[model samples]
Target: MTATAVAASVPVARGYRFELVKLWSQRRVRLLLLTCWAGPALFVAAVSQQSTLPVDTLFGRWMHATGWAGPLVTLGFAGTWALPLLTSVVAGDVFAAEDRLGTWRHLLLAVRSPRRIFAAKVLASLTVIMLLVAGLAAGSTAGGLLTVGNHPLVGLDGHPLAPADAAGTVLLAWICVLAPTLALAAIGLLGSVALGRSPMGLLLPVLVALGLQLAQMMPLPVPVRVALPGYAFIAWNGLFTSPAQLGPLLIGITVSLVWAVTAAGLAYRIFLRRDFTDQAYDGAGRRALTSGLLPLAGVLVVTIAVIVPVTGGPSSGIEQDKVQRSVATAFAHLYRLQTEQLHRPAVTEVQLDTSAACTRGGGRLEPQGPGNDWRCVVSWHLPGVPAAGSATYQLDLTPDGRFMADGDGPKEVNGYFLVRTPAGDAPNPLWQFDGTVALLPTVPKG
Candidate 1:
């Protein structure tokens, strides 16, 4: 048949079959799947053998108490790197392998349509991803049940669930992660197609994930931060909480779907537009690298150079004035919580003069950025105290408008004090009783 006739026929079924063969024929693919499937089991075994749990994670504290906690802990840790790596292994190479093998020119003629080929590759990659996620969920659930007792799971909502009910919730959490997992797969495919190399395709997606995680720590607006893919990846944590809010989960799934479709579509367009007949460029690895990556690197460098100055300038950077205001506000909240804890009458933040004289070390206060340490003299009113009292505190600030302070104030430094809550609310009961909390001095209103 003529090339034109073959193009007109565009056999999607045959294309899909070929793609599946390409994926399964490789021994490396089998090894990767084996690794992914076995990872959760190994984790469960190691964690069960340990004497203590890593209580920093949401489900870690209860991991030793029930088998149900295994799935939750495994999900938390795997989402960090393993899921992305597993999906990227295939998605990153699906398209680029054709170029690396110099098969694109022949395939272009035989496949009829780039879009169909791209679709088939994506379908195969996503199929593998689904299996990977399923393996993780199954292995984690089975390992947990066998290693630990299948007792009831105490959910984040402080409610207890029967074994069957907890199993259902665990499945839902796994399903929640599948969308983000596919989204990462799509991103990996796009990077592979766009970069047209196995290494770049594999490495770039992981780097993008890391970059998104860092962006979450920046002082970005709430809406902007929530819109990021990383937000959706982590949003699944809310499912274990009481009442199990589904809003964030639904939003995360939607955002991930949109990103996946958009990225894959763009990758298809680029693949269709590129010429595959240039043997010299396609065969020579360095030529392809220099031609494709150099300009992209230059643009990225320029963008960073411009963004750093604008965002890091005096106008936008942390300043002494902002620090004083923030410290005063933080202290007011802290003081109110302390008063409440001490059973004193509630006084409004405005009534407590929280003015602070902050200085760096023993020198005058200097304009600085996040992570700087400082000392402050906080003057405030104690309940029924006739005169204003002063306390010294050591403060450390973060770029994201968050801070930590150590109280050197009398008797208070050694016992429980108030610290800012994760949501920036005051009087957070969870942190109210922490002994290491610092006091924010507040003066009595005239």
Candidate 2:
């Protein structure tokens, strides 16, 4: 059979199958697959044995006890570099492996078309990445249930999630990450096609992922940050929380698709126009890179320019009335919890007044921005204590909508005071009341 006839006989799907089979035959690929399915058990064991949690990562604080937190913790670590590395392993080498082995020239002449080859390579890389993620998710979920137990999971709102619900939520979060993972894979493919070297292709995409993660950490404009892939990576954290905000998740999906598709398109254009005859290491490499990367760079600049000004910042200033209501409601709920700790009378919503004049730095507090200098004059009645007269509270608003307030309360000798002391003892109680209160955003009543 002629080479042309053989190539012509193979459909796009067959080409993809062949590429996948070639990858699967590699010893290194098999080892990577094994690691993907096995690493999570080790992670579970290590985390279980630790006395302290890795609070630096999202969901890390809850990992010690909740069976569901295992996947969340894994995602946090994966967001840093693991996902990028896993997806890049196949993508970085798929195209360059052809060049490195001096097979591109033969394939270029014999293959049905460059477009078919490009599509086949992309499908193969995506299949490997999907498998890697699936293995990790399955391993992590199994290890967590085995070691941590399927207890009810605590959410961001301090509410409890049923074990069944928690399990489903974790699965959804993993699905959410797939978009960005594919984007990372696309990035590696771009590097592979552009540089035509396996090692550089593998390393550059991971470096770019790292750069995007850094950009997320810095105080870039919200639009710019959200436009980046890292934003989607971290946004998955919200799914574990009560009253889960789906807006970020939707935005992340859209942005990730845009980035992956655009990047893959750029890479495809380069591959489609590539000349197999002029296979010089330097000149061809430079041309491939310049042609592939320049358009994407232009797209990024134009995107930033258009989005930054449109999403500069909140223009309609903060309304103190809304702030007062929100703060007071949050305080009432948190105070009820604190009362429970002290074994006191339950505080109800009807017992509290949500009206107050709030101020920041001696000015009418606008609902916008974060500051350490907000004050609210609030009044509430306890069971025995009379109208604990309108007291002045110093409120510190965080950018994430949480507030901590220290209010002027009953006068004390020093620090906190105990309610009941042991008879015949030095009147020292096991618990005491402090004047500080921490408030979270008001969870909507069902």
Candidate 3:
């Protein structure tokens, strides 16, 4: 029989819809789907019932653990492992499943061309992937809203965001996060096609993902990090805070697409040419990558090489502003605490020991309270001079409202205190209180 005659005898595929049905009817595919939906609901339910999740954080608590709880939790749930695995279920099986079952020849014979057969398989795999992802998004979003409501979103970056805007960002963020897995799916499908092993298509991409994840976490060059498919999953970091991070997410999606296409193209070429008859169904695999994907791999390599030098910071001395602010805030808390704590209160008591005060701590600090009320405390111990021999002294005030220092150690010592004026009034400090020489109201050291 002539090659042309053999090819001509095969039937053309009517549409992807027919292939979709054939793919969907598989028991494994149905089970994969059922598990995906059930797992999320069970997770949300268990968490909601047991969680002490800050329900009162000004964002109305989840109305139902299932509805509003899912989307909110999905970042942690699916972004890590579920999405990638979910994708692999179909991708690893798409083309390879036929080969594993010894049905590849039958499929090619029916479709008339390897290209059409590959298309139908890819189409089916992608359809399943898209639906599964959509299902996750829909179920989780609805769960989160039902349980948590459409209140303002508190983002990963510690900023509060309105739900209307946050919803868009969250959706974008999740989709972008999906890019890495989507890319893996493409690669896995290729593995399915090339290896004729259902598990290899699923497992190999995951191992690669793990390897990339490890590499991603290391202190690699910025360009290297940017090129990783695993980079998109890191976007979950942005879920808690925003001005939604679009920059890294966008770059990650590009990297994912490149890897995905490269894998898919190679799979396509191998499937079209490689003879299956009498070929070992185990151990051996496609030996070469296709010509079409070479450019993509080259571009990735070139981009990483070029970008590393320009963005890597110059080796030099520097001061970070973030550290400075943190130090200042610490100073503020300490200053307030000491000032309030150190100052001794007099309840018509006898003579009390007093200490000298320093105006400020080491850091550059501005006085916070009203005019000249910028009082500070220091641990002071007056030395060298002996006690004033327990001299009993009387205190008196002058007409100009100055408490005369007629007592032993000069009557009144003036110090700063915070005093506020009436509303719409200028800032002022009233009656500078004396830290020393307490005017005891006829009370003694009894």
On lDDT, the candidate that comes out on top is 2
Candidate 3 residues 1-446, lDDT tens each?
Answer: 21112436333355366578877888877886776656555555544555354332212133232243356566545655777676767787776666567775566556666666677778777878877777677766755665446765533222345677768766776677667877878777766766666366557667766777677545454566666777677644433432333555566677788788777887777676666564356413425343433554686787566545543422111112211221222222222322333343321101223322222222244321111212233121223335522211121221111121111221122122222223332211111111111110112221
What's the C-alpha lDDT at position 144 in model 2?
78
lDDT of 3 at 153: 50
> What ranking of all candidate models by TM-score puts the best one first?
2, 1, 3
Candidate 2 regions exceeding 4 Å error are 1-9, 108-110, 281-284, 288-290, 305-446
Quote the positional error of residue 185 for candidate 2 in Å: 1.1
Model 2's alpha-carbon lDDT is: 0.65
> Each candidate's lDDT (Cα)?
0.64, 0.65, 0.50
List candidate 1 segments past 4 Å from native.
Answer: 1-10, 281-446
**Cα-based TM-score, every candidate:** 0.64, 0.74, 0.63
Q: Show the lowest summed lDDT stretch of 10 residues, model 2.
A: 427-436
Model 1 lDDT, residue 271, Cα: 66
lDDT of 2 by residue, 1-446 (tens): 11222345447798899889989998988998898789986787578668776754545656665778787778777767788888778888788888777787676565657777888889988898898888888888877788888987655443457899988888888999988887788888888887786477877668888898777545454556556765678667566544575655666677788778888987887776666655554223667557766766766666555545544442221245545765555455544544555566676756754345678877854444456688777556666666563545666654333345555444321123233322321211111111111112233443
Instruction: Give me candidate 3's TM-score against the actual structure.
Output: 0.63
lDDT of 1 by residue, 1-446 (tens): 11222437457778888888888899988877786688787788679668776655556656666888888888877777778777678887888788778887678678776677777888887787788788888888777888887987755433457898888888888888888777778778777777775477777667877887788567553344445555566777556544454654666677677667666665665566666666433322454345444543453344344334323332323455555655555566556655565566897766776677777755654555454467666676655768876666676654433355556655452123333444452322222111110111122224
